[model samples]
Target chain A: EDKVVQSPLSLVVHEGDTVTLNCSYEVTNFRSLLWYKQEKKAPTFLFMLTSSGIEKKSGRLSSILDKKELSSILNITATQTGDSAIYLCALFMEYGNKLVFGAGTILRVKS
Target chain B: NAGVTQTPKFRVLKTGQSMTLLCAQDMNHEYMYWYRQDPGMGLRLIHYSVGEGTTAKGEVPDGYNVSRLKKQNFLLGLESAAPSQTSVYFCASRRLRITNTGELFFGEGSRLTVL
Candidate 1:
C-alpha cells in the first residue's frame, strides 16, 4: 500500500531554535512531493520537490529530497511563535492523479 | 479571482442527517478533490474528480458521495451522517498539465459536527 509517514508527531522548541521534520513515503511510480503549512484554517503551499540531491529554500525554511531513501526533510531555522502550525507532506503518484498525504507534524515554537 | 471557495464554513447535524458541501474553483483547474481531517489522522482523501462528469473514490470514500457536474464545481454529499463522520472537510483544485507544478490550491475547510 502507498503511504506517507512523518516522524516526531509533535515538537516543542523555543524561539531561535532550529527544527527538522522528516517525511518518508512508499508508493509506486513516484512523481513529486510537496510541503504545506496549516495554521488555523486551510493549508498553504511551502515547497515542491521533484528531484533528489537538490535543495529548495525560502528565507528560513528549506527542504531536501532523497529519492534513494524515499524520504524528505523540512528544516526551519530561527523559529518564531508565528511559525507554530502543522506541517504537512504530500506526494503525487504517477498514476491516478491523486496526491497522498502523511499525518502532519505539529510544531510549536515558543517565544 | 476567488480561487477555491467552499460553502457552509461550519455545520452541525444529528445522526442520520444529510448534507452537502459545495466547492467551486475559478482557476479553470481540471482536477478537484475532497478530503477529511480528524484529530490525529491528518488529512485523508475522500473522493476526487479528474474532470467534469467524472468522479472516483480515494483512500477514505465510505459514508460519502461526490459529484462534478461542471468544470468548476465539485460537491460532496453525506447520505447519512454519523458521529464518526464529524470532521473538517477541505476542497482543493489543480490544473492538469505536464508543465504545471502540480500544486493544489485549497479552500478554507468546512467544519462539520455530527451529534
Candidate 2:
C-alpha cells in the first residue's frame, strides 16, 4: 500500500510569519506531487511538482519536491489571516491515475 | 464551466438506510473518483472510474459501491448507511491522456450525516 505522511499535524502562527509543511511518501512508480488548500468546501489546487529541485510558486506560497528524499515541502511566507486553511499533499502513481494523500497539516494564521 | 458537480450538497440518512450520491463533470474528463474526508484523516478514495463503463475499487472501498454507466457521470452508492460512514464526500475528475501531472478538479462536496 502507498503511504503519505505529513509533519506538524497542526500549527498556529502569527501574521507575517513563515511556515513550512512537510509531506513524505512511499509509492511505486512515482509520477507527480500536488498541493491543495482547503477552507470550508473542497480543496483547491495550489501547485503540482513533477521535477525535483525545481520550485513552483504562486504569490506567497511555494513548493518543492525532493524525489531522492521521497518528500516535498510547502512554504508559505509572509502569511496572512487568509492563509489559514488545511494544506494537503498527494502523490500520483506513475502508471495509474491513483493519488495517495497525506493526513494534511492544518494551519491557523492569526492577525 | 461547472467542472465537477455533486448532487444533494447535504444529506441525512438513518442506520440501515441507503442512498446514492451523484457526480457529474462537464469537462469531458475520462477519470472520475469518489472520496471521503474525515476530521483528522485526509480524503480517502472510495472508488474511481478511468472511463465510461468501468469502475475500480480504491483504498477504502468497503461499504461503498460505484458505477460509471455514462461518459460524464459517476455514482456512489451506500447499500446500508452507518454512523461510521458519515463524512464529507468529494467528487473529482481529470483528463488522463493530456498530462501526467494529475491535477484533479473537485466539486463543492456533499456532507453526509448518518444518524
Candidate 3:
C-alpha cells in the first residue's frame, strides 16, 4: 500500500529558533511532494517539490526533496509565533491523479 | 475570488440520519475532490470527479456517495451517519491540465459530528 510518514509527530520551539520537519514516503508511482500549513481554518499551500537536490524557498521557509532517499525535509529559520501550525506533507502519485497525505507534524513556536 | 466554497460549515446528526455536503468552485476547474480529516489521519480522499458527470472512488470511499451533475458543483452524501463518521470534510479543486505548481484550492471545510 502507498504510505507517507512524517517524523516527530509534534515539536516545540522558541521564537527565533530553527527547526526541520521530515517526511518519508513509500509509494508505487511517486510524482511530486507538497507541503501545506494548516492553522485555525483550511490548509494553505506551502511548497511543491518535484526534482531532487534543488531547494524551494519562501521567506523564512524552505524545502528540499531527495528522490534517492525517498524523503523530504522542510526547514524553518528564525521561526516566530505565527509559524505555529500543523505542517502537512502530501504525495502526488498515480500520475498526479491522487494525493496521499501523512499524519503531519504539529509545530508550536512559543514567544 | 471565492476559489472554493463548502456549505454548512458545521453540522450535527444522530445515528442513521442522512445529509449531503455541497462543494462549489468558481475557478472553472475540471477536477474536484472530497476529503475527510481526522485525528492522526491527515486527509483521506473519499471521492473525486474529473469533470462534469463523472466520479471515482479514492482511498476510503465506503459509506459515502458523490455526484457531479454540473461542472461547478460536487456533492457528497452520507446515507446513514455513524459516530465514526464524525470528521472535518474538505473540498478541493484543480485545473485539468495542471499548470505551474499544480496546487489545489481548498474550501474552508465542514465540521460534522455524528452522535
- Model 3 Cα lDDT, one tens digit per residue, B12-88: 99999999999999999999999999988899999999899999998889999999999999999999999999999
- TM-score, chain B only, every model? 0.97, 0.97, 0.96
Sort by DockQ, best first: what order?
A: 2, 1, 3
Q: Which ten contiguous residues of candidate 1 chain A have the minimum total lDDT?
A: A25-34
Can you give the lDDT of residue B50 in candidate 3? 87
> How many Å off is the CA of A108 in candidate 3?
0.7
- Residue by residue across A1-111, what tens digits does model 2's lDDT show? 788999889999999999999999886477889999999898999999999999999999999999889899999999999999999999888755788889999999999
Give the interface RMSD of each candidate: 1.0, 0.7, 1.3
Ranking by lDDT: 1, 2, 3
Q: Which docking category, incorrect, acceptable, medium or high, applies to candidate 1?
A: medium
* Model 2 bad stretches (over 4 Å): none
Model 1 C-alpha lDDT per residue in residues B5-115, reported as the tens digit of each score: 999999999999999999999999999999999977788999999999999999999999999999999999999999999999999999989866568999999999999
Better of 1 and 3 by lDDT: 1
Candidate 1 per-residue lDDT, tens place, A49-101, comes to 99998999999999999999999999999999999999999998788888889
User: What is the TM-score of candidate 2?
Assistant: 0.97
Q: Candidate 3 residues A2-111, lDDT tens each?
A: 89999889999999999999999987466689999999878999999989999999999999999989899999999999999999999877563768889999999999
DockQ values, each candidate: 0.77, 0.86, 0.72
Measured by TM-score, the strongest candidate is: 1
Considering DockQ, which of the candidate structures 2 and 3 is the better prediction for this target? 2
* The 10-residue segment with the lowest total lDDT in model 1 chain B: B96-105
